[model samples]
Target: MSIPIWKYALSMLTYFVVLLCITELLRKKYKLANIVWICSLLTFPLWLMGGVSGWFRWAKILSVILPTIVVGFCRIANFEERKGSFWEFFQKGWILWFVYGMLFLNILEATLKDVSLGNYANAACGFLLCATIPFAPKFWEYSKTGEGDLICYTTVGWNFLYTTWNLCFVYGESPNYFASTICILMAAELYPIFKKKPELYIMSRVYTLATHMILRSCFGTMFLKVMDASTWYNASFAKYWGILNFILIIPYLFWYMWQLHTGKAEISFKRGKTNNNVTTLNT
Candidate 1:
């Protein structure tokens, strides 16, 4: 089978351009990070709209255009600042292993292209390894305390959940889940680098809200398209799942909004030294 060369190229270009722009904003107009995120959010619904309508043609076109525009604007704005060293920023105690584990799993799935009971077993074993390994506690601590400039443990936790879902449900060779999984994972991995930077956090939360909103809306729209109102209302699984997700998301959304309003939503590094430094000492 032939690959969709143009689509792949466009996707990569969009990602690079958007990242470049966001990086610029992180340095210059830090306050506008959230706005940048809001911009990124628009792409998701366009994608879903294309998906539910089976407008693969238009979806592919949009997947490229939207990201390009968002990123281009960021680049033109030219807003970045100098900060910590990459190693200083990235070197966390325990969290590295979790990241490594994720990378490992991504590689395995990409190479293997198969998921079976055995694969699930291996994943469980890997998780166990991640938990029991000497480094696990450190990672846990880093995650909990937001050490090494880590912002929220939610970053890794969300990525883990999203990646697990993708592996379980969207493991096809040419995975449609790539955009979502990659976006989330990259954000989580970079959380440490951007930890001391509040602007980045604001942008990230905005991005998260936008992404989730688009996803939920798209799913809702798709449900409407596929099932009549009567059928949807009668479908206990869909009905309850949607309601539960909505209820759960409400508190989270409110909390995030509170943080934004209170200016607590920005990324922050730990002040002074950490007392409970459980991770390996930097060499």
Candidate 2:
């Protein structure tokens, strides 16, 4: 299928507007963690635009990579601003490296294959699944504290679902599907390392991922059937799926916004006072 220029343009514009709104909201709410969440959520556009080579592809790369690098670097250097132990550093660093490295690889793959922007965007989406893997640890750790449980579970579920959808419906034999599957499985494996209730967490992670994958596959199949029913209906099946995915994302969006708002309170409650010094985690 030939890439539609207008559709890509509209998607890019929509992405920019959403990103700007999310950024403004985060700033107003004083929520930095939401930045990452926002970046992840916004990868939808990057996925779409980067799949086909265009200005939007470059825009997508900059949007995801720049803030990720900036935030990761700041967190590492400004230990006073964010307190963590050596293990925490190691965990976050690994995630940072994974995201950045996969992003580099995605761009390189696109360049080498001389694929269309659509395929390039698909590559970007595949890389996002890769980025989500390292974050599983952090999400699992935070959830064990009895907070952000929904967000943690939902994201784990969503990425796993995304992997399944790509494999069964979008790209069964494609290398991207295989890579995404590996990433999702590896991410699920990291859940056990975060807490004492390792078994429960591991089970929950698996269930969530599996459930989401099934749901997504079913949805995709049904949607395709509906579209195949008629040619005169002017159904853009891919666009519809994209819209459905975005709508399904609303819960996570709100969950993340809440997390950002409450994060400050949680930090304040834990610290009592904002101390600009190195804070160590209990081993």
Query: Of the candidates shown, which would achieve the greatest TM-score relative to the real structure?
Result: 1
Model 2 ranges off by over 4 Å: 1-157, 164-169, 172-236, 264-283
* Reference-based TM-score, model 1: 0.30
Error of 1 at 5 (Å): 5.5
What C-alpha lDDT, on a 0 to 100 scale, does residue 85 get in candidate 2?
60
Score candidate 2 by lDDT. 0.36
- lDDT, candidate 2, 1-283, per-residue tens: 3324564445434433433343333323323543543444444543443343455444434444454344333333333334466435533434434433543454344333323424333444444444333232233222212222212222344444454434322332233233223333444444433333322232333322332233223342332222222222222543344344445445644554565467743342222333222222222
Task: Tell me how many clashing residue pairs each candidate has.
Answer: 9, 10
Supply the global lDDT for candidate 1. 0.37
The TM-score that candidate 2 achieves is: 0.28
Question: Candidate 1: worst 10 consecutive residues by lDDT?
Answer: 143-152
RMSD of model 2 against the true structure: 17.0
TM-score of each: 0.30, 0.28
**Candidate 1: residue 217 lDDT (0-100):** 42
